[model samples]
Target: MTILIIAQLTIQETQRRRILWLGLLMAISFLAVFGIGLHYIVAELDAIDMDRENMEIATGLLLSAGLYVVNFLIIMMTVLTSVTAISGEIDSHTIDTILTKPVRRWEVVLGKWLGFVGLLIVYVALLSGGLMLVFYLRTGFTISNVLAGSSMMILQGLAVLS
Candidate 1:
């Protein structure tokens, strides 16, 4: 119960941060650039009447590159978001207040970590899935290893989070 409460509070605190909003805006802009560039490239390929085989390969390569960028972004975001979670509270003397609560120290630690991890997981899913959907819509192609690739990205983020 205490852990859950702390987790909820952590989520709320992070949600209220200006950094979160800034990060989101940057992400949207990044996706826009990627999407527009890809659309133009695909249009040029269509003008040349590229064969299906080449198109499929090209689409797959694009997905891989896009996901690679997303992977780095997620990793960086996770690091930045978590860097201040504990230290900030300590500096602000907020840790004193939380320590006086009924919750154990470990509970506080675990709750904050879990809360951030949950948030990052949702973020990764939405960005990756949205990009993949855009790719599919723009070109009737799908990466053969999309599921596996996404899972790996998530794992990589978690690894860095720890």
Candidate 2:
């Protein structure tokens, strides 16, 4: 219960600070730009009558490259959020308010971790899912093992979130 309360409060704090909004906005814009580029590139390739094997290779490279960028963004976002979690509250004396509650310090930490994990999961789903969706809808193709692939990205983020 204590952990849940702290998690709820941290999520609220994130909203109040507008970090969540900014991240969502950035994700949306990134998706839009990437989708446009991908569509036009695929159309150009089709217009040139690119062979199947070469076209597949080109699209595969493009998708992987985009995913690499997404992974980098995830890692950077994780670092940014972690840097601000406890330390930011301490610097601003907001930790005092949380500590004054009948909450153990460990509970506070765990709660923050819970909140962050939830937030990052949502982020990964939106960005990665949208990327994959665009790739498929634009090209009539699907990546293999999407579940395992996305799980790996979450684990990558968890490494830094820890």
Best by TM-score: 1
Q: Give the alpha-carbon lDDT of every model.
A: 0.85, 0.85
Pairs of residues clashing in candidate 2: none
Give residue 61's lDDT in candidate 1 (0 to 100): 88
Estimate the TM-score for candidate 1. 0.95
lDDT by residue (1-162, candidate 1, tens digit) is 888888889989988988777777777887888889889989988999999999888877887789888888888888888889999999999999999977799999999988988888887887888788788889978667777877887888889878
Error of 1 at 140 (Å): 1.4
State the local distance difference test value for candidate 1: 0.85
Q: Give candidate 2's error at residue 77 in angstroms.
A: 1.8
TM-score of each: 0.95, 0.92
- Model 1 segments beyond 4 Å from truth? none
Candidate 2 stretches with Cα past 4 Å from truth are: none
